[model samples]
Target: MSDRPKTPTLDRVHLPSDLKALSDAELHRVADELRAETISAVSETGGHLGAGLGVVELTVAIHSVFDTPRDRLIWDVSHQCYPHKILTGRRDRIRTLRQKDGLSGFTKRSESPYDPFGAAHSSTSISAALGFAMARELGGAPDPALGDAIAVIGDGAMSAGMAYEAMNNAGHLGKRLIVILNDNEMSIAPPVGAMSSYLSRLYAEGPFQELKAAAKGAVSLLPPPFQEGARRAKEMLKGMAVGGTLFEELGFSYIGPLDGHDLDQLLSVLRTVKARATGPILIHAVTKKGKGYGPAEQAADRGHGVSKFDMITGEQKKAPSNAPSYTKVFAQSLTEEAERDDRVVAVTAAMPDGTGLDLFAERFPRRCFDVGIAEQHGVTFAAGLAAGGMKPFAAIYSTFLQRGYDQVVHDVAIQRLPVRFAIDRAGLVGADGATHAGSYDIAYLSNLPGFTVMAAADEAELKHMVATAVAHDAGPIAFRFPRGEGVGVEMPERGEVLEIGKGRVVREGSGVAILSFGARLKEVMEAVEALGARGISPTVADARFAKPLDRELILRLAAEHEALITIEEGAVGGFGSHVAQLLAEEGVFDSGLKYRSMTLPDIFIDQASPGDMYAVAGLNAGDIEAKVLQALGVERLESRRA
Candidate 1:
């Protein structure tokens, strides 16, 4: 018997206009049903749960008060937009979330009219909103695209520098924009719901409120003083520490630390702002993540990401792993190295659990640093730690490390600081799509002057590389490993520091040579086996270092083989490109040596399983065999005879 909550009120709401007809009490009922629906849909599909639950009333309030699609509502990162999707005419297809050729997990403009801007990455909403806000004021309103822009960003996301940069700009612009600071973490501004509203009302009518800086566009709708003993009241509120001084300093009229779950308060403030707000205003609504769901509320990260689960029991049905994940290998190996060296330390940008640094933190809490979502600052902070003689392993996702690239070059590479980068998610991630794909790190990091880059073929190799990074203090080094469970290879009793800039020959062959970088080594071997039955035995070698170019091994392979094929799970300018450059310099290509480089094509692939995505890329075992046969100018039909 499915205990799915009956949504009589929600069934009437097909769009935002339908929401406006409902009373405040009825709207609360709608939010409750919506929350139940969100949990139920996610239980079937397995996606982001806690974030959506936290913002149910806020989503309801915004849609009811403001004209969406006209009044642009941008969800920062959009991890919490499941409920927003439910409200904004997407409830029917909500069960198809994160599926192949179905609705995306994050906010996409193509998904619906209500999703004004696409966002999977954090700290980008404010900038996008400002652009829309500016366009609206400048008479550049396009059909169904322009209106008052509202960016709903979380407290963790605000820790990034870009959010402040956008806030600084939004403050200067003074466009009729709204920023709802969804402080679920309660890291910034304590929860004092009534006190927050009282102070906000008084502050809006303070002595500073009357002075409208029209030149800078800092003007409030509230003209002057409001009531009897107002000055004394303002002084008392100030003493109570109930004002949003940080946002106010940025030139936006700030409001609320109100109860986001309270429909009455939410509706009241939103209606007032929609009618009378002159410039940028930030509504600080403090709500608990996983607000209604008991299991989600109890768990850390508030059930942020999930697998398909039973709605009744709140138990996830994740597929059991045969081996440890690459993330765990890196964390465990780094912890092992830390046991040997007292100077060793680890850093992560707010994803301690995701990166497996929570285990490290448990063992050595003093050494493990969770720097919040400030990747740029995390990179530089690691650099500073390195300069001061501590060996800092900055563990960040390869996609996110792009945020701190300039810092990587200027702070670590230029100065020659030995900051070890343990890059997780080094290839296409499944449902998160192109935005979270770790496809560019190899190309980006390898081009730097003194940087050394390595990609682990499997979990065991990842352990060795962790050891290698710990021993190598000469300059900056990075080692990347893919997501999900590693191939069940035999575990080494202890890690051994591998020699720098070397390649290991995995198998011996004669007709052709297949040089591989990264986790594609396993696929290369499978291709070799498929080729073996056709009498085309190919030499296989793992090029450990992409930058330094395993000179002796590559040259020997190039000299002996009739054809050479290089493969990597990265874009064009990555490991294979470096191999091509090395071969060209050595005049290997001059001899008309049949050479091919397999790289990810110049296209952004959408959400699919990693296996399905790789199939789309044509880097599978069969794809590799076909490439080899073509390179050798041997017909597949003819090769079978030999």
Candidate 2:
């Protein structure tokens, strides 16, 4: 299209090999073109923008210097892989990112040979790279043959323990592996903890870049005759500047604090390392998250994730909504709770903004804790707070909470600590795809002894649940809500504490009953409306507590209704499974009552709009109504179209 950037240099490049033919000067031109193309593409497709923008020059330098596909290149969290994708034969579909049947926002092994390993989570790249290196050593090669393994990981990702764990093992193995620490001084939120500070000190202590900072171990890269002089020169320079002693201690050679945007500098360092490095080596390349674009650099998150936008102005084309998002509602409600109770505290794992803990942090900075990317530490830390006589609300995304399950089970549930878990992104989150969905928390939490699990039907219910979690200091409690805007309901002045293990009947009827466990209650109501048109009014109830199972309501519904259907916004092992088990144990099934459970299918759903994903799961209103009819053995409905 005419709106697309003029990328004369990038247009000539269809694969990594194409960059090999270009001069270093021409390669710089390609970097500029690639940046422009990335901005243009993300402005249309509405995916990760700044991460890719930051790495434009790095992308060009790597592809030009190294043999990719054969040499496995891994991107930690892979949100920055957009530029890499555009250069590797996927530019034709670059504009279709994160859409249904489109190219994924993150790297996927199935997508292309360029992407050897896929990940959306952070800090796994070094481990994966070491695996590739070991595979190469063991003569276990796939087609095209594995050569070198290079991990381009962010400093934000370095906060996680896994990165260090991999480094430790890699050092012990003594394999030839390369690690590029892409330091942008930012993750999704500004990185927290000692790692960020440690990296800052490395460059801040002195003019290390001016010294052309390379580790003392770089002397080992020299030829035998030149090694003595190079060692002497390295020792002189090392005394003048700070070195990465921490990395060197971990059993790897550390080099850099290089200007990541300078293509010539990147190429020089990379070429040297590629030719001469033995064993695991670390290259610290400092970058800016939003390197080129003016608007992106100015934004708070550096325009980390964006919707389609006006290309020139960089004004996002977001659909306006009157209803407050579930995240905001939770934050506001929690803040209100904190006002009443001094002991109330909040915790998040490197996602204060995503979990809406940013609002809480603004109000109660001391009480709000961001534990960086360490979910296990965050969970256990929250448990310790509870044990210390403080009410800790660990607001984490459903997918991320999975990482802390062992802690949740041991530190909280087993000990009966009153650590409140506020699980955001509780369902199939659109655009981010299955990797980020909150589908297993219900099953996982509910099964644990003395754990209280709840799912809110709407924002109002979420507020009430927050209050309930505050009031009930019995055991480990969790309440899950979906990702986007809540259904527009009348606002409550304050949250109310509801009775534990109780459910509310939204509408009462006769032959069939629909039991909803979460946000899917809205869709159930819609299905109920449609069913009423056919002169079949089914009873609809919101089962507030999934763990306690609302036994009385469930049993009463089973006794009165001919057919009962349970619906939830989770995997098959969650709410519906609990209800089925209860019925089976209670002998309700022997009485010839028709029962059905609706849940997200066994397969991981791909990225699409929320509506489309729900449709695929067969959990939408039409599907619900159809399911009701199927359960009741009602073949047809009266048509209003005639």
Candidate 3:
């Protein structure tokens, strides 16, 4: 903060309205200052630095050319909205990005009018923007007005089929929509899929570029001086049967493969499009992911997501962890399993690094698959692999797994394809917020018939679950683990396969029992210690599998204990709900047993530290203690603190 850079041109603008007052030259200066400001701000609050740096000029140009808030500007994924936040009215709070109760890392509709559509997930902006565009034609939101709808999507986002679906519908509806494809040749990882290859070829060679334009057949849309020559060129290409660009064939005007970093080009094209666009239009702009930032540009992944770092040396100030990250543990366990079983393979949906499957890919290149951003395809593909006698572990984030639920249910669960699911980020993720939180996987997966759902209490348990999944081929089985480092514990030489639907007594006590699931066992132990101070020793048990409930152990606990509490880092209708159903069915509730379930509250948590988010969810140690105390009918002074 002491070395906060001065933003001269950016300092003058409070909002997009102020941007309109500046000359084109001044706007260029603004873009420069904006980049400085973005780097400085993200240096202090590290989150999605490269993407924001990539979109500085585009953000400035769009704001300068279009009347935003009213025009409904939607950013696909919205991770690059940091520059937009600064250009809009939130510049003052730029440094507070992704902190507790601070500005969110992603766009939230309620946070500002500028973010008309909230998005942290990718490829959704086009669909949302098209909705706004169609709404304008059909008398959408405003009392007397409906303006233009523009979506600035990434080249990576284009890989998703959802983008095409929206474009197809937008083409059919024929609304005046503007779609900016920010082609940086990268997403979180390197871009893949047909769309990326097509975009890459669009700018690779001279003949390809010229032929691409001719293929688009946009002669009249060309400049006046080149129109006649372009028309002759287009006629030749038409005879060659390279009719038009994919976008043009889909009923939208295709423009560019333009220079996104050049303010002059971006501003000129935006203004021209604003003035003349009729139906849907695609503006392809090529730019570097970490533009104007030396450290970010040099780093692998283009410093996509970062930790708070030094401005001079881009050295991240990440705190040291006591143990390997849960992601790393999963990778290690899976690698060992793969070594044992040649039939084992890994599949990830665009998150090879994040899921730690990149390591697996290194060890077993032929066995690992990176499916790009297509989760649905990845899920079904894994199912097909399983059907072909391969033990395919689909390693995907819990939040992202929601996208492939239909495939998971239909192709895997219903068919009992035995596609093992390695669900990462199974609880409230800190800075990435609720959009990325793995809060509902337990509920969603457990409810599926013939599906086995397990939660890891610690790193050792995760290894066992990985082994258990490898051994099981009865049906679709899944195990969820939270983000961040595991609680430090002794490393096991190899994972032992555990019996399905079993519970293990971690600590035995008398009056009350706490059935903990997932990584909440650490907090449960802390809660037990706190309760111990009050002379209220409680029994703690780890309920490994939620789908096949441990009826004997749970019923025994219910019958013996005065009260039993279930705690999990998931929503309602998860392990707790299943236990409740089991208790009611077994007539355990008839004995007047006090039962309580501690789960995440019915609300989306905002970006914050993991501790702060857990506090908000009322699932922290103190909250767990209160639930335990309340269940046992103990009148405690500390309950007020919780």
Q: Pick the candidate with the highest lDDT.
A: 2
Task: Tell me the deviation in Å of residue 29 in model 1.
Answer: 2.1
Candidate 2: where are CA atoms >4 Å away?
213-227, 232-244, 636-642
Worst 10 residues of 2 by lDDT: 209-218
TM match of model 3 to true structure: 0.96
lDDT of 1 by residue, 234-257 (tens): 445544543436777898776655
- Please give, for residues 1-642, the per-residue lDDT of candidate 2 as tens digits: 998889888899999999999999899999999999999999998988999999999999899889998999999999999999999999999988999989989999888989999999999999999999999998887676789999999999999989999999999998899999999999999999999998987777554554444432245555789879866665576556665368878888878778889898788788888898889999889999989999899989998999999889999999999799999999999999999999999999999999999999999999999999999999999999999999999999999999999999999999999999999999999898988988899999999999999999999999999999999899999999998899999879999999999999999999999999999999999999999998899999999999887999999999999999999999889989999999999999999999999999999999998899999999999999999998877764324333
For 207-326, candidate 3 gives per-residue lDDT tens digits of 545654443423445778987887677546533543346887788777766778878777767877888888899998898999998999999899899999988999999998999999
lDDT of 2: 0.91
Q: Give each model a TM-score.
A: 0.92, 0.97, 0.96
Output the number of the TM-score-best candidate: 2
- Model 1, residue 151: C-alpha shift (Å): 0.6
lDDT at 381, model 3: 98
State how far residue 420 of model 2 sits from its true place (Å).
Answer: 0.5
lDDT pick, better of 2 and 3: 2
Ranking by lDDT: 2, 3, 1
RMSD of 3: 2.5
